[model samples]
Target chain A: MCGIVGLLVKKPELREQLGALMVPMLVEMAARGPESAGMAVFTAALPEGQRKYSLHAPVWDYDWGGFEGEFIKRFGPEAQLGVQGNHAILTCDEPADAVKPWVRGHFPMLHILAAGRVMDIYKDTGHPASVAERYRFGSFSGTHLVGHTRMATESAVTPDRAHPFTAGEDFCLVHNGTISNPYMIRRKLEHRGIVFETDNDTEAACRYLEWRMREGDNLETALGKGFEELDGFYTFLIGTQNKLALVRDAFACKPAVVAETDDYVAIASEFRSLAHLPGVDQAKLFEPMPEEIYSWTV
Target chain B: MDGVNATDRRRVFDLSTARVRDLNQFLHHELPGSGVEQVEVQHPGGRHAIAVGINHPVNVEVKGHGGYYLAGMNKLASVTVHGNVGWGVAENMMSGTVRVKGFASESAGATGHGGTLIIEGDASLRCGISMKGIDIVVGGDIGNYSAFMAQAGHLLVCGDAGHALGDSLYEAVIYVRGRIKSLGADAQEEEMTDADRAKVAELLARAGFGYQPSEFKRVASAKKLYHWNADANQEY
Candidate 1:
């Protein structure tokens, strides 16, 4: 079992308190999933010529200064790295296709969690509260965020196996239920020269939706095809640069409750996760219907 | 606030300060002759299993939304939630009445043996799933797959019923006032007889509704999927 929490603040001023509000929501779900926790936050878009890549070092004390110096020397002075323990955001003026390969060759041990102008990903295998503290998730500021706490039902427990799986750019997805046909979707995507990161079923779903969007389908169209091709029970919460979408399986076996106020839209596996939110007493709360896509724009 | 207070006969519990376990313990602590007969839970904050497993004839009034299993296995207690409720409220209730002033999530009265659960607002999927003798009355629509495999009970939906209503039914009777999206396997809609109208009127009166009984249509088991069809291809 896994717990999923998503929050999208409607007012721009509340963006600064996004993590502060979401920290409690994520922590409350620790009982649902205590093995690992992760979150993907969407900030304001960077300058048009800039792109940021979330890099996770192999060790907590990895020499980010040396890595930053080497990157500046190779990619020119336009490269800047913002360090945060083992994770850092490398912002460069170069394109992703050009910079990604160079980073992989020079720093092969570093894992790239995400790449986009607006999104930053953080995940680790630990208790939700500890993981949030390790990454200082409470200080994060963004327009919206999607978080997950995983229990590792089918996959092995590792940092790389954590959720909020990113596919292409700012797109990320978290799942609660298992997919019965991950290899089938993988094989289908592999035929089209799509590479996979892990054997995790959520990754297959994540990459498939990214592939669909890359092939000129909008998020809605891709999800419609997903409902037909993807065979499993899933309550998927997806994150993008501008929107956060949620959908449940046909049976509605898994639980999901949504609370929307004039200022924000919050979703969780249960109501307690959102009970402490500000103005929640007056918020309109409802359960998402089966097989229905509910998306909120930033 | 005046009637329910810090007294032997009436009590108040603020879940923000007090523990839910404590409240439940009080309900079961020699409840037969205990003078504690009324409870008011304030600031529930969506806690689970509040006021559950009661055997006394007490009155519980929850002021806010409730989480899962608000009052399960209740006997002779009349529980009322002024706000919404989460999943499986009043599940397996033995006797007495449970009422919700707001909406309810999935599996409201699942597997309840005996009781009357009234929802003033809509109820999500599987409202009365596998109900033995409990009667559920919803003031608004019910989601899909409601009353699946219900053995014996009366489910009254004042609003529409979603897809596959009463799939794989046994002996439960469903009364829908609004449209039924679809009926489940071996579950067919029948003409409402005078007895059915009287039942609806009785339940509606119990729920304090003003809707006319003639508006409801009866749905019951067709008994087709009951016996084994050895020669049939089970294509369904």
Candidate 2:
């Protein structure tokens, strides 16, 4: 089992409190998933001609400053770098496809968590509260955020196996239940030239969406198609650049509650995660129907 | 002066500080006829088993949602959830009432032997599977495979029912006001006789649902599988 939480701020005034509002929710999810935690925050859009890439290393002191100099030497001096906890964010004028290969060839130890204009992914293997504190999540300001506390069902406990697994450039997915046929799906996806990092079922599902989207299917279409193709019990919270989508299996064995208000829309594995949100009591609350796709945009 | 004292001052437990175990412990420890008649539970969403295994006739009012097994093995207590509930809200409940003002997740009243479980909103899959003698009244629709293998009980749905309304049912009576997508093994629709209507009316009134008894369609076992026949072996 795992716990998934997402917040989409419809009111601009509440955007600054996204992380602050999400911490308590994530902490409450500790009972469901205590192995590791991960989060992805979509901040304000980047400036024109710039893109951001979030990378992580195993240790806190991983020579991020030196890596920045090396990146500038290779990708030109127009790159800006900032390090938070074990993650390093690089904003550059170069496209991700061009920069990724160069970084991969040069720094094989670095793992790219997300590459997009608005999304920055932070994750680690620890208690949810400790991971949130390490990244200082309470001070973050963003239009939307999605987080996960993993119980390590099918994957290792390494930070790389933590969730909010990235799909395409700006897409990420967090899952609550195990997929029974991940290996079968993985083989099919591999035949279509989709590379996989871990043998985790969530990664397979995430890659399936990315593959479907790449083949001209929209997010909703991809999710609808996923419901037919993916077998097993699962509740997924998917994050795109500007949209957050939720989907559950037909049986809906996993728990999910959604609350929508004038200011924000939130979803969690249980209501406790949503109890502390502003205007929670007055917010409209309901469980998502089985096999239905519910999406929200900022 | 009234006999109410400080110990019976309507105990209030906040889930933020005291866990669900604390509340369940309080309810279990309270003996019959204890002065603690009313208990209010605040911040109820994240916890599980909030008032399980109770024997006293107290009232528990939870302020918000609840996790799995909210009132499992309940007896005599009247527990009310102002919000939704997770899986098996009142599993194996012997006697008492478990009410949810909002929705309930899968198996809302699984294997409950007796008591009343009321859901003001919809209930997910298998709402009353294996129920022995409990009475479940849902104000909204219920998901698929409800009342599967139920030996005895009464299930009342005010709204539509998903596919396979009652599979492998025995003795249990089902009443639905809205559409039943399909019926499961050994389950078939039956006539709502005068006695059945009276029973339905009594249950609806007990749950505060004002629907007329004539609107409901009754479902009961077909009684075909009780004694197996050699000719039916091929079908099996």
lDDT tens readout by residue for model 2, B173-203? 9999999999998899988899999999999
Error of 2 at B2 (Å): 8.7
Q: Kindly provide the TM-score of model 1 when superposed on the true structure, using C-alpha atoms.
A: 0.97
What ranges in model 1 sit over 4 Å off? B1-6
**Candidate 1 local lDDT, B1-236, one digit each (tens):** 24544576778989999999998998888555766778899999888999999988989999999989999998899999989898999999999999999999999999999989999999999999999999999999999999999999899999999999999999989999999999988899999999999999999999999999999999999998889987668854
Which residue pairs does candidate 2 place in steric collision?
Answer: none
Model 1: residue B236 alpha-carbon error in angstroms:
5.1
What's the TM-score, to 2 decimals, of chain B in model 1? 0.96
Candidate 2 lDDT, A212-236, residue by residue in tens:
9999999999999999889998999
Superposed by TM-score, candidate 2 places the C-alpha of residue A113 at a distance from the truth, in angstroms, of: 1.0
Clashes of 2: 0
Docking quality category of candidate 1 according to DockQ thresholds = medium
